[model samples]
Target: MCKEKIMNSESEKDIKISKRKTSYPINSELLDYLKSYDRAFKSPIVYDDLLRYVDNYPILDKDENDTFWQGVIYGPQEMSEIHQNLKKIYSRLTSDGADKSVDHLFVDSVDYCTFGNSHPFRIKIKNQFNDNHDYFYVKKADASRIYGLEIEYILSPNRINFLVFENTLVEEHISGIPGDVFIEKYLDEHTNKIRLAKEFVKFNERCFLRLLGDQRSYNFVIVLTPDFDEMQYRIRSIDFDQQCYEGKINLYKPQFFRENLDYVKFVTENLDESSIKQYQHEERALMAKRMIVGKSRLTKLLRVMKNDQIAPREKSFQLKTEIFELLKDNEVLKCETMGDIVEAVLNFILRNYQTSMTKLF
Candidate 1:
């Protein structure tokens, strides 16, 4: 039997609804920021164009299980037009409008998912010469998701490449083993369980500090890399729809998710309170350093985010109050939007860093 008995804590139960009802539209200021950063482009195609597909079939995984994806098929003339436009877009994304590099590439399949908030279409491109393949996503652009992508690019260790054109957002695929699959298949085989636990601690801290939410096991992936002697694991969030939209503070922390109980159990079993605190501090320091390095760009983005509305007032107020209660700092109480909450968190980190420095003098 699998060692799945470790997730029995009362706190492991699902506490809040995980889905968001509506997506916030991208506003003007955020659009300007995207345009300024070369993230906005003009495209011959938009998200609605893909909806003209005549038929679709259920996409199945290797085990013949329905993957919640439909293989979209368009008529010949429409397919030709779409394939050409998609190739051009792919060139723009990867080669800065150099179409010759992807001349030999062809669109293999387009898969759409209707289950989630974004309702993204997954595009698969393959090289005719060597049959090498790559994937990308085309989704209707949402302000919250855009902010999440930018924050992940700036604040996290990973760099993401994406572009916005009108209502469509194109995201480069992030490759990794889905977290649930990793927990089911690789958890027992992983030699360095402590490192895995440490990574989860850091990931939890990162998500909470940035106010990202809904990071259940299915929403993120675990990447494994071979170190000189051992393996290193990194957990990256793939779904960005729920970024900073929840009322409860615990929603921002991945450890609170029932689907991630295994990871939480790992941390609780292998790490003591002191170690967890150290990991959190370490992540915070790294984030602070990243902020310093990207100060100009980050500040500009935050300004746009602060002026934009991504969540309801009640949700924002609840989050602000919870943050203040947690820190015993009332500054967050003045935050009006989700962006303001994020700004308050950043400022709080800076203040803590400065105080620590002053103690050394």
Candidate 2:
């Protein structure tokens, strides 16, 4: 038997994710599952269509910092066609295919980022009447990312809106303060540091529970909402490219990321062990409840995922061994895919919940 390489807190600091990950094509079963749930749609444009732009210029932030995004320019005929098709896609995303609603809407700018695995294109749409604007993304629909998005929607507190059309994916822009910006500017000024820390703890638990990895500061956002007397903070992940790909379990926990060192320190400084444990248990309980409520949909998704090949076999084997050791349950060792690993994790949580309830009774 091979020894499980479970990462400890000390080892987590040295963990590094691979620079590049192979994109997996969506298999027939997953596509059918997506179509059954209305997550699949037909779009006039595909991911390759956007790559035909002739030229591009770098986009800058308000502080004159390089955002690593380029504003792409297209030929007159191509631009007109792309813009019109994008508007139609936006209509379908937001208003259930009401094309007339987008008659007054125009594409303001199209930006592309070569930063990560997806290499997504950002589309800015504006309403001519009120000058109100919104953003969406177009990217190659990698099966791993699609599964991540679906899992986030089904399990997390947040609701995700995205549509898959052939090889393209359209996602509604998640609105919030970038995590790095929040850390730099808002962390000190936050009226309720405890609440923010608490939310981070919950967010950390959510990510690890679902095996969502590589939650560096920039990959997530901080959403602030006014709560009568004070502001409430919620952390939401913006990137899903790393979903269930890493072999290291600690990679799923955001606190282990160096980019999130500030958050980790805050959590340690403010939250004692018991408080942290309470928050973790609370999050797990909530997730268990969500699992029960979304059982049918989750079942279908997992069925597709278990049969899909989203990660390397070595990674799947390593992760399953580590998880099996950590939980002291042989069930995880039986998992052959990342999806099976996720199913095992969820089952572990549900089993623990049932045991606790039985003890209470």
TM-score of each: 0.95, 0.95
Which stretches of model 1 miss by more than 4 angstroms?
A: 1-12
lDDT against the true structure, per candidate, is 0.87, 0.89
lDDT (Cα, tens digit) per residue for candidate 2, span 273-348: 7787798899999999999999999999999999998999999998898888789888888899999999999999
What is the per-residue lDDT of model 1 for residues 146-180, given as tens digits with 9 covering 90 to 100? 99999999999999999998789999999999999
Backbone clash total for model 1 is 0
Cα-lDDT of candidate 1: 0.87
Residue-level lDDT for 59 in candidate 2: 90
* Model 2: per-residue Cα lDDT at residue 62: 89
Best by lDDT: 2
